[model samples]
Target: MSIPFGHQQLHNRYCFEGKLELVTALRISSGRASDETDAPFIRAFDGAPYIPGSSLRGAIRSEVERVLASMGKEVGLISCTLFEKDACAEKARKFLQKIETEKVKKDAGSNKQKNELTAEFAKLELCDVCKLLGSTVYASRLVIEDALPVDVAIARNHIRIRDGVGIDRDTGSAKDGAKFDYEVIDPINSSITFLFKMTAENVTDDSDRKLINLILGLLKHGLHVGGKRTGGLGKIKLKETDNAFYKVSGFENSTSLWKAIVNGEKIHNSIEWQEVIKC
Candidate 1:
């Protein structure tokens, strides 16, 4: 007898690899006061700040969910395929029934069966109904680790909203000239670190190019990040021997991707495909 086997082993191997990272942008307003509720109710900091790990994870999951929905695969599944092979087992049986009815010699019988079966098949063939489910299921497999700040920006032109008003009328004018910063640390290897020092926005070609140049600068100067904890803040150091890859930008703004292409720069907004350098 011939053996019939599936690719379960190969699937298992491919399933365990990590493939994505999500970053959430964080903002802390300066020149403002608290509401006793501990909520940051001040205009102290300017513009939206760096994103935290938790926020990044939430955003990632949300984005993944959105992508899944857009692709028609938003089903909630706990393991493996979003739908079990058995989910449509009964549908298969129904399909067979329709086929058999089509073979009937009576035109009325065939017509009746065809109409009824068409309606039933519509339910099964709908990708929209089941795609979201599949997407949710697939997204669940995504391993989300704690968010580490990659970069933060305090926009120069950004206005602080105080008591629901713009900066001009507010006590503080976001003009303290905001500072942008991000964290890149070695999760696996502590010895290697890279500090992606990003400056406040300046007049540049495109937002993407500005970001790319900033990142490239960070990488270029990142070699000096180990054993040099000046402020005790965590930082990552890029090394000569590292395999790093920029991921696609997943921000609400899709136009930023053009910066990289237009300038032949390596600035990426997407964090999913980024390859962390091994220390």
Candidate 2:
């Protein structure tokens, strides 16, 4: 593994690839009403249902935070809630701001040197989650691609609409004229598999690397994605053999890298990290 210093570089790349099954009906809303339903599942340009990388990343980050919040103190680590603007993140934010402000005054011979300075500072300052997933200072090493249904026909066949309403807490009844129906992938019949792949660069720290593995383990047990968790939607899980990790190298030194032709590039390491790594 290579370290990320003074500036970030593509010294090493790791991709955690896997197949995930929908354990329950899923409703990832497109945020707008469709002609057929009040809330429709988001789709690609070709109309095939897809999970956006950002959405998946958000869910992964959220779960990781929850797990850490529950068990992190036991391990002598603290996972800060970035959403709550917690002190852990506040400290890192301030450090980044100070560095950014002072960068103009320093010699910072080149862009690489400036990045190196910032990256080094972040390595020592950022929390475990923010270090891997990004924060006010460091960019996230994790990159998740859109997860698509392995069998598009199956996904299409099992999608159905379910009725929903806004509850009037005061009266303990449904609000008048608030009735609506939203789309969902039928849980019983839609046991469709989705391909998920994410790549990261320079995750050399032992703790930081384990955080990535923790996410895979969490997904295997079960996790929710998209919207409607209260209604029991968006349940997904992984199989025993689904979590595959590949550490790819040689791209930086290879001339054919940019052409997407790294046939002979060194595959530094390969692993089924989920089986051996612990949170």
Candidate 3:
């Protein structure tokens, strides 16, 4: 099948041509809002109540759009046929329409006029990618992508992928980490020109290809979190003093990449990072 339009072409000849990176740093604490049914109806739905996958996918795509925009390229909402005739899309359409209508009614102060609105029509439409990929890559703790350098390397058996890094939220210690939790990264199709922003520094390197590569290398390898747990409730500890340094690292790359693109130029990678000292 021919590649679709309004989407960045994946698997290109140049690293910077079709390849780019965007890192996102999530404010984990900000995610704890409850009683969101009182929030704007557009914001509340009956999905997992966890972070929405579409929100993350939208984030990645938005970053890609920003990078393309900087290059004087124009792209728009990547409308997908994946949702056109499918049951999920139809369901999503009906669901959104109902909620939007209800929102209007609620805003008009329509109280207690009970209509036969089923609970099924209020769920959020998750990103189809998550269903296709079979895990929550969209809502995972982190997502990082690197445009592969043009020269492809050949190796026997499976090539070793690099480890990404994470920092302890409590103590100011840096630890090697995976870009995502298990069942998340496994099904990603590298042939596609999309990757999750791993750490914040990757989005705007100061044209320091070497430094960027060095940092990516350090991150590409798995960083360890000192704990013995599995799944979403994993644990780690760092001294309080160093917390801010790592927090900065998380934002240096993803959404901030667009901020750097102000005045029609990409921001230089000039931020200084210092290792956090343990208390």
Candidate 4:
């Protein structure tokens, strides 16, 4: 594929064009109350329900982190939590101190300074998750756009309300005055189509390629995007309608490449990157 202007050195870019089909009711709550409902699905300004990009990105990142952890990779830096902040901070501080020590030793004409610097550089390097999703240190190479309904008018028919009640832990029964209702997308009699796009840039390293493949696999398999997972809400399957991998530095016309991607043609390989990676 061809690279656009101002991106002369662009290595590889992958575009994920897909639709999410709800297999079960989906509830991505807006956290707002209305006269007719206690909970409602998030909606656009025109009242058309949609999924936020940040929500999808967070879900994908979490799944990738879990997969990395299972493979025994060093995900400590990438999956650092609020409770681990102090420990991570101290660990980072020690890394800096070690580099400073190596610098001091080099000033004294030590021969092992180069090896120490190399080791420290490897240690301080960002993990694959941070490199793709972004960290406090650098920008992300992946971009996920908000998923909007392919047909807004048709989507309205899938919207419905579900009732529930909180259960008391002590009594193992329904709590008094705990009944609630929420809106969800009903997939029993209707199917809602969503358009999603994911753009990945600078995918030169083998590790990054592997990570992306893992994420795409997870997406294709299925995911619970919204709330009420315990109640079996938000069951979705993503189907890729179009995809393109651009590797060349430049081309005569950038518009044609985009047009080809949208038409799901002019690609050399299938959208399945998992076949290329070991995982």
Best by TM-score: 2
**lDDT (10s digit) by residue, model 3, range 13-36:** 112112221122111112232342
Q: At residue 37, give the lDDT of candidate 4.
A: 87
Deviating ranges (above 4 Å) for candidate 4: 1-10, 72-124, 166-175, 240-275
Candidate 2: lDDT over CA atoms?
0.72
Residue 52, candidate 4: C-alpha displacement in angstroms: 0.6
Give one digit per residue, the lDDT tens place, for model 2 in 256-275: 34434446534543533333
Task: Judge candidate 2 at residue 143 and give its lDDT.
Answer: 79
Q: Which stretches of candidate 1 lie over 4 Å from their true place?
A: 1-25, 28-38, 41-50, 73-141, 150-162, 165-279
Give the alpha carbon lDDT tens digit for every residue of 1-279 in model 1: 221111111111111111122111123333334443222412213432332333333433333334434432223221122355633334445665766666664545555555455444533442322211222111111222332233323122221222222243365664354432322222332122112222211111222232233333343343122112343322323233335422233322224445555777655333332222211
Q: Write the per-residue lDDT of candidate 4 for residues 1-279, one digit (tens) a residue.
A: 433211224555667667877777888889997888889889999998998888888778876766666562542224443245443334545666776786787675354654444334333565556656765433567888989988988777788888978678899999999878889888786778788778777564456667777777778787777888657777777764546321222212335446657888664233334335552
- The global C-alpha lDDT for each of the candidates, from Candidate 1 onward, is 0.30, 0.72, 0.28, 0.66
Off by over 4 Å in 3: 1-104, 107-142, 146-151, 156-265, 277-279
Error of 3 at 263 (Å): 6.7
Better candidate by lDDT, 1 or 4:
4
Candidate 4 TM-score versus the reference: 0.67
Candidate 4 global lDDT: 0.66
Model 1 root-mean-square deviation = 20.3
